[model samples]
Target: MEETAGDHQACRERPAASHLSWAGDGPETRSGLALGHHRPGETPMSHHLRTLAVVGSACAISATLLSSAASAAPGSPGPARVDAAGDATALKRPAWTRLRAEHSKKCVEIPGWSKRQGVRADQWSCVKQANMQWALWLVQAPGAGGVRHHIYAIQNRNSGLCLTVDAKRNGSSVTQRQCRNKKYGDNYTKQLFWYTPDNRFFSQYAKGKCLDIAGASKRNRALTTVWKCSYAKNQRFKNIK
Candidate 1:
């Protein structure tokens, strides 16, 4: 009972009844209202209503698509991308600088022109010595909740030793120590310092303490230490490039 080739050709050639109704002969069809159903004497108000309905539907569809696109877009802000080699933000990377005491106008230096660790840091004349210059690097502290907190390590350009606190207690002397590039934990915690908007280096380990010139001394070779931050001139420092 297999159908012949001619029978198959005839079946393919025959159109379905639904297709015939869509050929401008019916009142309405699946595609839309048949053109033949619209009388020549149709009211102009009805035509305007139909046109408005189509425009409103298109507007609604466009609004929904725009809303979906906006909802699916990325929301979180991107991380700040700064060039390390450029002069964008100097504190964001390690840069050579001269630390000038606000009260004494002297630059920070290592004693006896030594680059060795355990040497006390002092303020001396603004000389062009390599030991007087520091390479400051900012390490981003952890637990930053949408706010940036930095720990700065100032290393002597001559000896490569980092400026550190002799002890973690208050009134500790600031000295040069072996550079410990740590962001957190017990190592180098006392050495980490944070710079404030008022141009003072605040000690991270010693709460409420800042890098201060001893006795507000204006004499050469005056020692630097950590004292209670009082917004005084002795506690302020300027990073001279």
Candidate 2:
């Protein structure tokens, strides 16, 4: 016999005695607590212990997060970052200033020429000495002849003396000639020369000043003038200091 519609509705609204049990037959309802929701088999005491464990774990995680945040907070000095900046600053310092200071006092010493006057050749040494001025020479050469030969003059402003290179008639001596600017055949060329504190000679005898030599002279007796650099045999000034 089929149950009447009114009877089914009444049964749904008013569940049977078995349905009144705390643990129903279905797995979700069978456990005193919701079955799959958490640990279904745990007793009331076990549930409390599990809750306590979760709370402790959450507290530990929160503490770690807070510590990390504090370490990164504003005004907190990060040691590695500070070290990196210091290293960078050290690297940025100019190296040449120290080099100049270190070698400033050392005078170049050479043979033959007098330290009192005339050009002398010498090597750079690390020592503070008055004679150091002679060790340094100003080099000059003309433009076109930079390849063939160099012209240079050694001058000591403090000593108020200058030296030049001149080829003697016999090549017998590397004469320390008086420094002067002499005119050549044209306005474009002139005499050019330089000297070393160690009595070394560097020079250019080409036909014109560095500027005028561009297209002027063809060969011998061309005028030459002093310039900053010349690759000529004469222009190479040995850096003693």
Candidate 3:
């Protein structure tokens, strides 16, 4: 479902976010209003928490609303939704983002800020730290063979390495490695990935396999691995907040 010009009125009954400088009609006027939504099965981020500590920028929040006013796309519910942390524009730019696994509600982090290859990925309590953020870089090889889905190199803000999967099989370990592609420079299939409408991250190493939380455990420090895509909560992740 997408939102258009009328979405601004969809939440007329709900009060606007606190400290909003203005309550008017356009982004040009810096008056654009935006709303956020939680995916099915996920807890709705509380507005109270957002007001207490906003995580995104004013430009991002406003631009998102105005952008949606002119366009619509799947997974794009309205202008742009700001979760408890901030505006939902994780992949809109080649920016570093925080990915939270749905089932555990934890942010993916490179344990201990290790900068070496083959370090397995882990999910931990969400925190405002560099290790928790990942920078997404699009792999541009339009007609490359073995390519079936849009791919992006998921790089960690702290480790400066791309997320890499060991093999194209279920139970394969997903680790971090230096981004290098002999044919396409940081476009190596094993280091590339794509997300589906179901919110699962599939590595180019195998479209059938998704980034999964080991054992579906909600405990902090649960390791992440590649598993057959099941659309299960453990495999679902969102780059919001």
| Model 2 Cα lDDT, one tens digit per residue, 1-241 | 3334454444346422211222343355422433223454657666556545544554456556656766767541121111112223123221111001111222332223343433433334334443334322223323543634343333332332333323322221222223333322211111233333333333344222111111123332222223333333222233433
Q: Say which candidate scores most in TM-score.
A: 1
lDDT of 3 by residue, 165-230 (tens): 888778888888766554543336777678766778887677688899999999999999999888
TM-score of each: 0.58, 0.25, 0.57
Candidate 2 error regions (>4 Å): 1-130, 134-151, 166-178, 183-201, 205-241
Task: Give the alpha-carbon lDDT of every model.
Answer: 0.68, 0.32, 0.68
Q: After superposition, how far is residue 87 of candidate 3 from its true place, in Å?
A: 28
RMSDs, each prediction?
18.3, 27.6, 21.6
Instruction: Count clashes in each candidate, considering only residues at least 3 apart in sequence or on different chains.
Output: 0, 28, 0
Q: Give the TM-score of candidate 2.
A: 0.25
Candidate 1 lDDT over residue span 79-120, tens digit each: 122221122223444557898988889988997878666888
Whole-model lDDT, model 3: 0.68
Q: Lowest summed-lDDT stretch of 10 residues in model 2? A: 94-103
